[model samples]
Target: MRILLLGAYGFIGLAVARRLQQAGHDIVGFGRDLDLGQRLAPDLTWTGTDLSRLSSEASWQPYLDGIDAVVNAAGALQDGARDQLAASQQRAISALIAACEARGIRTFIQISVPGADPAAKIAFLRTKGEADSALQRSALDWIILKPGLVIGANAYGGTALLRMIAAFPLVQVLAFGKSRVQTVAVDDLADAVDACLAGEVPKRATFDLLAAEPHTLRDLILKLRRWLGLPTPTATFDLPAPMASGLARLADLAGWFGWRSPLRSSALDILSRGIVGDPTPWREATGRDLVELDVLLSRLPSTRQERIFARSQLVLPGLVLTLASFWLLSGLIGLWQWREAVAILPPSISHGLAASFVILGSLADIAIGIGFLFRRWLIRAALAAIAVSLVYLAAGTVLAPSLWGDPLGPLVKILPATALAVAVMAIAEER
Candidate 1:
């Protein structure tokens, strides 16, 4: 089969594309970042396509040509600076379905969630439900596979959140700890999709692809901790619902700046409601049960790299925010006490030159801080911070070498800040 795989660069999509390719299918990958998709899977052809822009049947027609099947693995948690929920999930899906029908491409596989409903309070689920309905009503051989919290070897989305929680040292802190969640291994999901394409599963049917039993969110976290070879927590702190919601709202606000924090309100709402679905339909059809969470974890690689990734994700947000605040406040304070700032320079430099230098440096600091706050500019911000820190260190050495020996150690402090900027740049790449 020649398959057009949407979101082929994403966590799940990439896994599925590999599975289909291993099964001897020609895969054409579609994603907003064609460069990333190509880099991830160089063997496959890739097209830079944004589903949010494919809001009409005509817009989707060109992609359907010579396509034997279409697997939609793209999705967004909520509307953000880079995401449009209704447009991407609902309108684009409807348009694609219509185009598929017109182009005589009958096989369409939709990857959805467990409790998607058009009338659901959460926009993510509602949009998914609307798209699922549109596909059901169309004249194509559609298969809806709604997987529960997907557990994959690669950490992303809910999986990333789980790893972050598990990485906490000695004490476990949680929100919605008791919410029940069923999980499907990423490999199982890929296999199920392959089964659908192979006509091993029923056509035009909805199947919940998950393990037979469910685990509480707390249990899942502990399992992940064990998987990562982390020590057991000495204590557990289950945050109150109100506090959890407050944090989620803050994360939601961060979304506007293009940070796709997993703790956003949409994610919280779904997790609190519980992630579950009947796995019997898929099992009955395929005569194979999905692996249990423990088994899934055991089968996956548990190496130093995995542990580093989990711990890095847990510390990343705090690190970024702290760095931004440090730079921002430093600049603000420099501007607020212009005379004091100028006085820090040696008597050899004139007052006018000192004042001008202070102003320019503060403005540069402010720019770096502002850049750090925006996700799109994070890498550039880190780079700028490092460059400016070097410049500051060199200038301080030249103008006020005595400050290096002072108790405050102003010049000494720049070393750690510059090192931090390097660290942020190292781990900033989302993919």
Candidate 2:
């Protein structure tokens, strides 16, 4: 069987693609990033095309031809430009359906999130509801798989949360910490997709794919922490609804300008309600137990690799601070000596220098990030960068005391970098 998979570069999509290929099915993986596609699932055929831009029947005709089924796994997990989502889902689906129909393709599998209430206020959930509705009404034979919180080794959001708990000895509990969640493993979900494609599952049926055992958010975190050999996290405070809402609103406002706020009120609400569902259908259909959360968390790379990755993330910000310190020191020297240093440098030259610093810093950071991502060369890269950044800071302080400002200014600037460096070290040691 030939499958055209949208969002094939995503966490779930990659897992599904791998499963399909392993089962001897040919797949055409479609995504925006050819590089990510190749990196994540090198074995599969990939097409780098913006799904939303291909709105006409002709645009999708080539890909849909000879495909056995169309799997719509494309959607955003976080808030982004409204136009992008509109194009990816609304416009992309319209074109895909038309192309599939014209090419005599009949099967469509729509992967959705279970707890998405159509009338709910969250835009993400609402858009998912709309897409589910659109697929149900289409002429093609369809299977909708709405799974609960998907837990996997390569998963982003939820897996990140688990890693955080594993790294931190203590964690603050929120309102939804005790709320139940029927987490599902990515592999199990992939199996379900494969089964559906194999015609072993009912058409036009929507199944809530989840783990057989439901656990609260707190329980899940605790298990993950134990798996990573970290001390259990304790809840310190419970945020009030008004306060949470205000913070969420502030985050939404900041998001307008590209400022990301980690916590949101809608997210809190989703957590509070908890997405609980029976996994009987998924278990019966796939005949596999969901991968244990503890096992998945434990399988994460060594502490050293995590440390290197964390260190790499700081390279860009560290470079920014380092260069700013140098620039300010240069200006101060010119001011004190009444020199024409500032006037001598051309504007273009200054711009070029700044760009060069950014490029070099970014490349170094990427190298470390990749090392961290692969769980290799972490300790050496992290330790080396930490020592270098510290030396740079110390030299800047001694050579240009004025640029360092009062002790308080230097302390303030250094604290965050020091904290970040320490975090990298701590994460690396977790392994």
Candidate 3:
């Protein structure tokens, strides 16, 4: 079957594209990010066009010609103004439906978020709800697949959650962590899409897809921490509804004023309400058990070695040059001063201190560079680098503030070195 897949570069889109390709289906992708699409499926025929730009029905008619089906997977989870999100959805999905109808495109599969309330004020969820409603009213044979938070190997959902847990060892549990969700693997969701396209499922049907096991937010975090070999995060505290709502409102206001909120207010609200649904429809239709959270978490590549290697490669050359340059420059300056009969003792004393400083700093840099280069020594190297950088900054600020700038400047200068060390250490320790 010839399929036109919108948002074919996204987490779910890539999974679907791979599955369809394996099943011998030809795919043409329409996405804004050509590089991402190419990386996901190099062989896929891609059209780099923003769906929002194709406002008129005639503009989208060509994309529908000879296309067996249209999968509307293109939408934003973040990074948009409230009005823009709503407008983009209406323009893109509405245009696609009208064009598909005009060109005789048969199957229209609209991917939407599970448990999105039509009355919700969150722009993302509300837009999805509106798009689903629009598809329902369209004349084309459509299947609406409302999937729960998707999880997959190398995908954003699970990986992002893991990263968050890694960054923050203590997280606020929402109202004693009673809010629950069921996350589905991207591969399983893709399989359902393929089955629908194959006419194995009834038409004009809407199904909520989720994993077999439902987990509370706290449980999910703990599972992720264990998978990443990190200590289980302690629940910091829970905020009451009224307080949580106030914080959410404050975040929304901050966002409106161009301040990026670390957490999404909508996500918090969704979590509070528990965005779970009945898994009966998915289980009955797919005839497969949903993937467990542990299974999905297990698939992430142990990135410790890779990160160490990457940091080492970046730091090694610069460190080597820094050492060589400092040594040569110091000697040249010493020799020039000696010939001029400038007091060698006082100068020698200063030069000796400087040389000691340079040697120690260089050794630390080299150790860090080497540690980053070899995954095994990452932890030791990181600690050595951090210790050396802190000491060097402190001494430099005291002795030669002019050369090192203020205390903060020295700290800033050593940040890249510190980062390289930390990355190496994290990877090495994990390995």
Which regions of candidate 1 fall more than 4 Å away from where they truly are? Answer: 347-350
On residues 15-119, what C-alpha lDDT tens digit does candidate 3 reach at each position?
898899888999999887687678767899998576667777888877776788888777764443322565567667777788888888879998888766457
Give the per-residue lDDT of model 2 (tens digit) for 1-431.
88999988877888898899998999999988787788777888888587668878799877776788888777764464322555676667767777777788999998888776556676667667777777777888999898888876553544544444345425644445677877777888898898899888889888888766778877775675565455455543455778767866864653443322234444556667787777777667656566655565566554555533333332423443343343344334434543243232335446556445444544454454433322234455556456646764764465444646665674347556545545555543211
Q: Is candidate 2 or candidate 3 better by lDDT?
A: 3
Instruction: In model 3, state the lDDT of residue 354.
Output: 55
Better of 1 and 3 by TM-score: 1
Question: Which residue pairs clash within candidate 2?
Answer: 171-233, 303-428, 303-431
lDDT agreement of model 2 with the native: 0.64
Q: Model 2 residue 89 lDDT?
A: 66
| Per-model TM against the reference | 0.97, 0.69, 0.67
Clashing pairs in 3: 304-427
The residue-level lDDT of candidate 2 at 373 comes to 25
- Number of clashes found in candidate 3: 1
By TM-score rank, best first, the candidates go: 1, 2, 3
**Cα lDDT, model 2, residue 310:** 31
RMSD vs true structure, all candidates:
1.3, 8.3, 11.1
